[model samples]
Target: MSVARTLFRLTLLAGALSPGLAHAAGLDGSQLSLLWALPFAGLLLSIALFPIVAPEVWHHHFGKISLGWALAFLLPCALWLDPATAGGVVVHAMVDEYLPFIVLLFALYTISGGILITGNLHGSPVLNTGLLALGAACASLMGTTGAAMLLIRPLLRANDNRRHNVHVVVFFIFLVGNIGGGLTPIGDPPLFLGFLKGVSFAWTFSNMLLPVLTACLILLVVFYLLDSHYYRKEGVLPRDPTPDNARLGIQGVFNFALLAGVVGAVLMSGMWQPGLDLNVLGVKVGIQNLLRDGILLTLAGASLALTPTTLRDANEFNWGPIAEVGKLFAAIFITMAPAIAILRAGPQGDLAALVALVSSADGSPINPMYFWLTGSLSSFLDNAPTYLVFFNLASGDATQMMTEYSATLLAISAGAVFMGANSYIGNAPNFMIKAIAEQRGVPMPGFFGYMGWAWVFLFPLFVLLTLVFFR
Candidate 1:
């Protein structure tokens, strides 16, 4: 049985290797048209609209919808482009990019979900700010999704007695779910994709620190004042709904160690170059990256084994969110290939007009344009692909992006990470945070309602960031 399974895998890999496989990464986007982006656009539109437009249908059949969009791209590529190249493209996208990304998200989500803040404190202005600060810090370590899920319930509990609390969750979504994740790639999906594309891990931290800190500090101050006003207006806090005198403590504390292990694995993957790779469909899967994914999976497994199911139950952990994200993003990554390829094709491609918008006459990148364009789209579209679209546009060469176009890269990074706060659906965790808040009786705003909040609080800060950094 083992021999047969191995033979089957070997035959599959052997069959995937073809002359077109070698050039799979370098597909000529100039020959492709904007029409090639329709499937990708349709998928994003489906994700953005379907929930609001047809909630039941989207909820039941989103997986099928995702499959349809993925096929929409793959089938066309196979028929119109070289079949071998299309085959290789799918393999490379799955094996090289999507696997590592989803593996890390799964590990963080699983491990962090085991952790529970067992007691809640009064949500005084200072205390609320502290929780937000801590969440932001944790965001960099465990990812925005993990950090938001771990901290949000406790935060809601802390403020459940307060009369005016919608602003609290709204700002929580801003700080913890978005801005805080800017400091490290482990913090957000977009940055992780950047790291995977050869932007050094340290480069993200170093380059992003000022912008992240500035945004975080300002937002924290705003939250504090806003909460203070609401606190004052409430006169006296309402009776605590789920009160307890028990000292605040954490369950699954060991998951923090596992979270650190996640960090070490990612860093090691970037720094430890063994000069070895497994050639799968002409995509070079580095030994270090493979090891990192293996370690992440192992750590996730360890969390599940070591942490009792009771802890997860107490935290109300479920697989539904991750499963949904897994399905949707599997398609997003597949469909986004042509978009990335087209952007990489630069002035020679169909997006030449787009290329012109972000570039100067001398062909130098206009840093501020990168910032706004990236952020504006990130405000509506998913930030991960938005970042990559701009990243590739600035220059697909990572080394050059790190050096010659460093400011442009910073603009793209900061914009993608920070302005994801501009709308509920801007980041993956944003809507999840909203859903959890609403479930907890917070009367979270509807889609456009949340954007109204962002327009008031976040846009001014973005303008300031533009002047301070991008300019």
Candidate 2:
């Protein structure tokens, strides 16, 4: 899940005592120019292009590159905006968003790494499809991150002997990392935010069923067919790496309890409010949130200490991807703040013309535009905040949104959950899967190259969705 709902509603009392301080601390997007987004765009372009252009340089200096882009935004904020605001933004990004996000992923990655699914299951078309299906089904229950982390290693192991198995990983990201999260509030950050804002727990599952099923069915079918073709073309696979023919079973079962702990932490943070906010600088950090993060870190540390190192070694557990994701996304979250603020500014922002497209002159919501716009932004920005923006933009009243405007809500939900498959940065797990697949010697596509896969496979379905559902 993303930051709890209370994080953004920083205690205004601290700001009221100092007017200039408050204005600087809370970026007024209506006053911001579109030029503020340059650093965000630049960082994204670097993430996309650098690996293809200079793999060695990217591998060595990506952290520095990301930091530079972050500075590009922060330096201006300090010199031009105000020092207090700049510092506040940095703290906000680190504490409010980045740390919790990374900690949850860290916990899942570590705990799931300890879970060894022992056995030599051949990566036949049918078997791989079944794995994808299983992972997807588990996603709505344990979140996209949990399901992906738990199943990815086994999937990779099963397909280790296959030459043309890159597509399998691609489809896995499509189904498990993105589309599978559509059915429940616990499944994705956006829906969880909806739950925080008073949307019923059953709302997403009930309303999103058809769209989720539609996506799963289409992607699963295409994947099976494509995987079958690859299987035939690459007949006589390389000798199985782990053909030890031992009975299939799960090892390091205690880690599952730790995973349950991770899920519980996220749920408690959102659902339990003690009403006590810790004043960190001018920002009001919720105590429950702090406790949730502590629990997450403790669980992660416990996984490292309690789970045998041999188990991790067998699973090829390494922190490279998580560390890299942290560095890159820290910059992403900071740089994109101005853009998110602009979007949150609604009709008054510099992007007012863009926001206007979501509604007509009479202010009725445009369903197709809602889906496409939300999906388009969610493809690049964090889907959680993007969903919140559209949620508030639509009505912000859960009862009204869940009833008279249910169609609009569904569009927003589908867009935020479904189109995350459009790009790796669209959701956290997409890039993780890509990195892990590459580390395991699968030739995963470059950023744009992966988008090409999305374009070829997913665009038609989106249009079809619009026609049948949003229209």
Candidate 3:
């Protein structure tokens, strides 16, 4: 038999066997011990350490590592819990959470790859600042990944002749890859997860407008000042690489419409709930969600078919980043199940001490604590899931969060989106941007080195934000 068929058969066999070996009915987070969280901790540690300690091994088999961690969670659950319950959790996690998350990412990745910007301008301090500002603005429209992928090469080309250009890429990640995505759900994964959980489409933009603008404006100014300092220190300006006469324009502009389609489809899913859902493995799969995913897939396929393959080549787009995110997050979603359940169990769970940290003695929600805790964890762990954990911790009801605990929700959203700049691993685009920059010969900072920059620049701004807004 073919390898694909063999794997498929084995998967079915495993699923079939799981239910027959049911031990307990289901997991009760309050009754479970902290030991249940080991796999998640292992996963996080692997993500944090493997690339640094063993880059070659990590580059090749990070997916396998993620799967091993996932199995570490699932196999125990299968043996300890009721077969139906264990099977249902796996199915629910995949069908409900993991599928939509990865599919949206796939669609965005594919569609954005088709749009390429071809010419470059001189990377004057003002020009670089303007490009960063422009990218930050576009981040909310097309997403941080899209904006970063679309503009990073041109920005790099613009600055290729410069002696001190590391700062440019660092600030690009600061403004465009992380903070810029704060304004819209479509702009970042965490906010999109919020939207999926029923946060209004306009809610993020409306609530985050001030914080996002403040952070972006501050970072842009800092970037401009730093660039100017470097520009002056360099004595003579480098010659522009592109011909002075070569005009700048985009290549595949049609993908803009497709991007909008993706946005529209997402918005429609939220606004046009028909109260119809299909139950699979005890998870309610909304028809609107299914339709949205279908539309996204169609849009992705159309981009691939209609756009010239040469444009994608010019963009240097590949599926590796998206594939990596898909595999790792599939593991993340499953392994985090117990952790999330524990958080959701509130003061009764084994993680009560962790949960209680966000509230005061009076049991009042501490907004600043929410921001820092969420943002700090997001800086290390995946921000999307971290946001979900805190969202549940704050109060899982979307309407309640939007109304009663709006401050808390805003804090969570801002922290997740903004502080993702704190490390290379904080957001998907951050590391990818770093890789692309390194590939083009930019000397990007090492992991801790990048954190040093974030500490110097971003932490102070976050503090200011907490003082002004989150408090």
lDDT of 1 by residue, 1-471 (tens): 332233234335534657447454445777789888899889877876787889889878888888788778877877887666566666666676667877887897888888888775888999999999999998998788778877888898888898889999999999999999988888987888798789987899999998999999999999999899989988977777665775789989999899889889987886678999887556678899889999999999999999998888877777776767677766776777787677667778998787678988887989999998888878765688789889987887899999999999999998898889987657778867776676667887766678889999998998999899998
Across 83-149, the per-residue lDDT of candidate 2 in tens digits comes to 6676666666766677778888888888888899989888999999999999999899889989998
Model 3 has an lDDT value of 0.82
**Candidate 1 lDDT (Cα, 0 to 1):** 0.81
Q: How do the candidates rank by lDDT, highest first? A: 2, 3, 1
Per candidate, the number of residue pairs that clash is 0, 0, 2
Candidate 2 segments whose C-alpha is farther than 4 A from its true place: 1-24
TM-score of each: 0.85, 0.94, 0.87
The residue pairs found clashing in candidate 2 are none
> What lDDT does each candidate get?
0.81, 0.87, 0.82
User: What lDDT tens digits, residue by residue, belong to model 3 across residues 1-471?
Assistant: 432233234344444554432222345788778788899889878877787899889878888888888778878877776556556556656766778877877887788778876666888999999999999998988889878877887898889899999999999999889899888888988898898788987788899999999998998899989999999999787686677777788878889899889888987887786999875444567899999999999999999999997888866677766766666777777787787667667789987887788999987799998999889878866788789989988889999999999999999999899989998878878867887787678988777778899999998999999999988
On TM-score, the leading prediction is 2
Question: Worst 10-residue stretch by lDDT in candidate 3?
Answer: 2-11
List residue ranges in candidate 1 displaced over 4 A: 1-27, 160-166, 189-207, 229-239, 377-406, 423-426, 431-452
